[model samples]
Target: MPFVLYLLGLAVFAQGMSEFMLSGLIPDIARDLQVSVPAAGALTSAFAVGMVVGAPLMALLSRRWSRRTALLFFLTVFLLVHVAGALTTSYPLLLVTRVVAALANAGFLAVALSTAAALAPPGAKGRAASVLVGGITLACVAGVPGGALLGQLWGWRSAFWAVALLSVPALFAILARVPAGAGDASGTGVRAELRALRAPRAVLTLLLGALVNGATFCAFTYLAPLVTEVAGLGEGWVPGVLALFGAGAFLGSAAGGRLADRGPVGPLLAAGAVLSAGWVLFAVAAPHPVALPVLAFVQGVLSFAVGSALISRVLYEATGAPNLAGASATAAFNVGAALGPWLGGIAIAASLGYRSPPAVSAVLSALALVVAVAAARVGRPGAVVVEPTR
Candidate 1:
């Protein structure tokens, strides 16, 4: 793998920290802004909504630009948004900043995915994609918790400042290393790209990606409660458990990438099946103190293994529309991210215990497995061919 891939991963880590660190800063933000905690939490939701909308839109708009240009543009915008967010006193302005930051983040991610694949040596695209995914897992492991610590010591604004600073090195590295013409649009026009998405295999693969991610977040979004309330651990154990899960995710990403390079369908089907069963086991063992951490790590491994493979598969299936392929995958994952927590919350509201989230997650994973099996049966593996737009 080229060192530039690692630079792209670094950029992703900074953006991902921004996405998740807000959870730890909600109370501080509410107090500082004189808003309710839920209102403050809306900032996170706003970012998620922006990501879902921005990926495809930005990809379409920037398709004609060189990948390096698009990436630098988005990273600069992201840096500026965080600085603006840090300095803002008005809650509404901060909310606007969050949405704008998310837009930039989404665009950069969409572009980076294709750029990584383009830059890698032939037959190593899956490993390249995993490098990017590893950045997110690393963010979960270190960046988010470090942001929380910064918030605790200084203020929530400090975390924003830190994110902005982190973007500086990524900006310079991308400028220095990423090839100028990498991931340049194929001249297929937006219509041809849109048509590629309509293929039955591509559609099913996208659904599979969403379901796999939804299952992950369904359980993950409520992990703290499972650790403290069900497993009888103290609040202090939450961070360690989350870190353990993240470590597993990082390893899984690397392993999945290598597996995907050989072929995506076989590994995806196998991992998806095990992931579904893992969630069921997780739910059953939630109340056992020793079992909770062990299962959390195992589930994290299985989840990202499936996720990385599905993403690589999506990219392969949409080869005719390279730019849109990455953006669509981004949108699908975010859609799952949003829906999973919502579903888990509903289960909790219905008087199901904290264990219910994992149970819900199990169902979602099974659905993903079903979709994967259907996708495998539908289309021959590899990119769909589309006529060039005249």
Candidate 2:
């Protein structure tokens, strides 16, 4: 394991922390700013909307440049956005900054994933992806807990300030280390790249990720309501349980990486099963205190474990266009991000039978599993950068 990989990991860690920390502190911000909870909470949604908007735009715009330079600019922009967030007093202004930061983050992640793939030593691409993805998992474990504590103590403003400060160390490390420059043109043109991505196998892999992530989030985004409303848990206890769920997620990512290294298909298949099982359990036993943690742990693991394999699958298909493939995956993931909340919200609104969400999610996961299984049958093992044999 080279030190450079660790530096890239730090960049990812810091960026992830910034994005996720907002969720835990929304209440604090809303109260402090004298705004509605949804108004204050719009910051999180703004960030996702930014990612949805920026993922493809930034990837395509930066297509002509070296990934390193493009990624560096993205990181720099995120740093500035954090600074603006820390300094802003107006709610609308703060939302704008979050949007800017998120846009930069979308581009940063796309480049970082590809760079990590290119940088990985022979036969270790999965490990490199793990290191990068681990940052996201670990952010939930660390960032949410730490931010909540800070918001409880000093105030929500203090938390953003902390993120701004951490940005300095992360930016310094990524720029100083991590050889990120791009290379001479490979003769594979953009049109050819797009053509390959439209292949049935490639589209299936993307949709699998999209559906799985959507299903997971359909359950996750409303986890607080699920815990409080369904399980009859107190509001005060919600954060603690969420922390436990984050821990379960970290473990899942670790196990998933190890399993994927052995074979991506097997772990993906297992995760999809786990996802379906978890949702069923959640739908059935959500009211039981013991079952809450049990279901949460399972869903956390399955949701992200399969995500690790999805990255490998996307890269394998888009060998000629690492940036494009990586960006498309990001877009798909965000699309699912948007879809889950919408789907869950609708279920809740319609007075559909109780447990409709997790039940629906189970069906979505089952479909994703089917797609993944079909995909595994066609592709060769490992993250092979398959080029058209001339």
Top-TM-score structure, candidate number:
1
Q: Give candidate 2's whole-model lDDT.
A: 0.69
Worst 10 residues of 2 by lDDT: 381-390
Report lDDT (Cα) of residue 237, candidate 1: 75
Candidate 1 stretches greater than 4 Å from native:
23-45, 87-95, 264-266, 349-353, 374-390
What TM-score would every model get versus the actual structure? 0.88, 0.84
lDDT of 1 by residue, 1-390 (tens): 888889999999999889867655665788899996446656766786788899999988788888899999999999999999999999999989988998898899999987877777877777888999899888778876677667767888999999999999999999998888876766777888889887766776677778888888777767766877899997567667777777788888888777666743555577778999999999999999999999988988998887776666667667777779889878887777767766776787778877998999999999877755654566543222112221
Candidate 2: list runs displaced more than 4 Å.
26-43, 87-92, 180-187, 228-236, 258-261, 264-267, 349-360, 373-390
Candidate 1, residue 237: CA error in Å?
A: 2.2
Candidate 1 pairs with clashing backbones: none
TM-score of model 1 (CA atoms) = 0.88
